[model samples]
Target: METPVRSARRESAPLRSTLVAIGLTIFGLLGAAIATLPAVLVDPMLAKGVAAASIEGQTLYMILNFVGMALAGAIYLAATGRGWSYVDFRLPSTTGWIYVLVGMGASIAFLFVVNIVVQLLSLPAAESEVVAIVGQDQTMILIMIGIVVFFNAPAEEFLFRNVVQKRLYEAFTRMQSVLLASTIFALVHFPMYVALADSIAATLTSLAIMFGGAIIFGTLYVKTRNLVVPIAAHAALNAFQFGVLYLAIEYNVEGVGTSPSAIVGILPSLPP
Candidate 1:
């Protein structure tokens, strides 16, 4: 009887794994669709004559993305029978404020360096639309940065690093799980830009950068087993980006472009 029961349990493990994978995949797709629904639905409606359609679309997109990711995370936790307690909030022993400061410094320095390199190499910036948006309306730009740097970045860290990566790490090898989650993270941003040759090239390049960053962030989470470090780091990086944009717009920096060099103050002719 014992042997039979053990055999039955062993047989069920694979089935359970399959079900979990299916659940996660479905949840992810559903989440993505729901998150983008505002852009899909509102953009057209606004085209017809909605007041502040652009702002409405942007606001809705941010809201839906947050809500969709949260819902998906909840579903994932439920399906896996993992209690909320499993979501670790432990910070590193080094101290929270120290981590925040270090993260901020490191992220800003890295951005500064990368911006210099990109500018020297004449590489395109990740999102040109962001520049145009900032140029048109500074208030909107600030709102966008608030959403992305603080809210969206933290939410993403929670969902991807904490929830998805944590679950997958339990079920699979650490490296495999990290790679998988990072791939998913990069892929999620696929349709944010146009699909033309230049756009596609830029998108792919940005994904590669994001994937590399995700790996580092994911590894940090695994090592610390804490969400706070990665969250801080992610937010820091985003805030740095926003600051760079603000400076660029304020200075009417032209020809300085999105290249790393332009951002890092390497190009003498570029605006400070």
Candidate 2:
């Protein structure tokens, strides 16, 4: 007989548990709907193109979809006698941090390669919608950090890896479960791209990137059996991307005819 951990790592989830997870994901969808209520009720209609691109709107959307649903899922799972830790979800440890660092490194490489492929394919490479919403505002940047790091990252890992992948593994092999869950994860992001992409091909290409990211995060979860590993990795990647964007937009480090102050910012300030 397999030990609990061994079975967890290998077994197919029960039908009832799987159903519950699917339902919880639905509730997460509802949260997304509610998040956009403000835009929905207004004359402008916040479905995607307009409200979805505002900093305030995006924050609400992320909070509802990530944080709101995350809490509900936790409660529901606990009621069903499967607390997060029961699913191998817990805070990171010293070793866990190491895995997160490694995961981040691998994720960066993965995204870099994916971006290259996307550009080569003549597909949209930037999530410009996100950048447009964030703009050059410092406050918006900080809020984005919170959303990406504290809410969106962990929330996604919790849902796709801890819940979806875990339950899927109950019936499928580990690899199959990861692949399936990653595909679903990628698909969920489809709507986000649809409004912003210039063409369907661009949206599809963005989905491909999401698919790749999902696979990377899912693999980390399976290998370590720790949610924090993937969460930190996801958060770290978001942080790095946003941080780079900040430096680029704020300082314009590489723009033509760069200003003296901008150049000075890059160089040593030297003692007064």
Candidate 3:
């Protein structure tokens, strides 16, 4: 009788977890869509009168999106009676810092190597595009960097790595959670302007690279159960990318640019 009862409870656990995950996913998506509604509706209307309206609109959209996600997370956690202490913000441990540094170094090295290969291959250069985007207003670029590195990175990590990843991990295995969360992260970036014929294909490729990166970050978070490690790592990575762009412009460096696909070339071949 005891053994049968325990088996029944164990079998039902996964089903309950899956239901929770599905609910969270739906809430998150809905919240995100609602958050962007102002930008979708109001930004264009005020575009002509206010030169800075576009930037303001983008900022508002980001703020709302983060707030919405946070609210949704709060609701889910409250409903489940999961302890609120799950939002661990402790700084990464010494070993975590080591991982962060190593990860950052590897990412920068990959970018450099890929740029060289891309130049040699004569692929399209991103320098011109970068310049066109950032050259017009130096102040705007600085502000944008501040927003992205400081505000955006932390918010994104909180949403994807902290909240979504944790919830997904509870429902699925480590590998499944990592892949799914990374895929969602990459999918969110697909609307950005790009020349790729199939945005979905490009997104999947980006997600794969991001998935690898996310795994490293995810592992650090799981080991320490701290948000700080992933947050620092996330911010550092964003800063590095910004630094690369700033240097590329400042030094007038030009080369055929590497897309995320170049990660394949940059990473060392694994043993068969």
Candidate 4:
């Protein structure tokens, strides 16, 4: 039988872990907000010097956004006394390969459905302030896609699937954790669309679309019990988004009377 003191300590361990997890989650959220400040607040200063259509500026904005969130994830791991295990990034088993296909296929289907929905409903089809304000030269679009697929997507997976959902799983059902994390994920991204939101309904529509995608990604993570599954799938989603955008630019797939930004806004979807 355990001693009284020993039994007390055993029970206390979970409480300690819960406390630490909660604190770290809050820190991660604040850190993410801080990280966005550069692009959200400071980038306007730099944009003035560069040409309105400079690809370099848009790339820089994305890089800064990703680095901030990724950095927050790293900080959360360090503060919580967790390591790669927090991220669960180990080489998955042979069977785990199936999940990769699962994520990509689901993402493709979601995008197709989303694209159809956008067309069916004549919604506000104007690009967000971020895209309209910065610039995207055709030469750098592929580069943008490469960064998004490799860095941006993985960084988000680490932050959301690995850190946020992983911690929440200990306190909630798998589905609960997925929906909660996905909701936060969607909300955090609102800054990207906030300026372009003409009304509450339009904003809600964008948020709902993103939340749905996050659910798919989160579900994939839960299914495989591996971060790589969601990461790969997220990258595939981003790849498709970029490919669509590039194709639009190349083919000038704009509705009559619509600006390039308007076409991008109305079609498939823009990166969020």
Question: Tens digits of per-residue lDDT for model 3 on 1-53?
Answer: 57988899877866675555556655765765565567656687333322234
Residues 178-253 of candidate 2 have per-residue lDDT tens digits of: 8887776666656656655667876777667777777888888888889889988988887776666667767775
Global CA lDDT computed for model 2: 0.63
1 or 3, which is superior by lDDT?
1
lDDT tens per residue, model 1, 33-126: 5665666575765333322347767556555666576667767777768768877776557765566566567656655665566557665535
Q: How many angstroms is residue 1 displaced in model 1 relative to the true structure, after the best TM-score fit?
A: 22
Model 2: worst 10 consecutive residues (lDDT sum): 263-272
TM-score of structure candidate 1: 0.72
- Please identify which of the two predictions, 2 or 3, would achieve the higher TM-score against the true structure: 2
- Top candidate on TM-score is 4
Model 3: lDDT to the true structure: 0.55
> Once superposed on the true structure, which residue ranges of model 3 sit more than 4 Å away at CA?
1-26, 36-42, 45-53, 109-137, 171-176, 187-201, 255-272
Residue-level lDDT tens digits of model 4 in 1-272: 88999989877765554554555545655664465456534456443532342465555655665666678889777876987557778677766778888778877787567656777786553344334433455566577677767667887788878888888777667888898887777765465556566666666777677788889889988888888888887887766766666677678776421232222221111233
How should the candidates be ordered by lDDT, best one leading?
4, 2, 1, 3
Q: lDDT for every model?
A: 0.59, 0.63, 0.55, 0.64
The TM-score values for the models, in the order shown, are 0.72, 0.74, 0.68, 0.75
For each candidate in turn, give its C-alpha RMSD to the true structure in angstroms.
7.2, 9.7, 7.3, 6.0
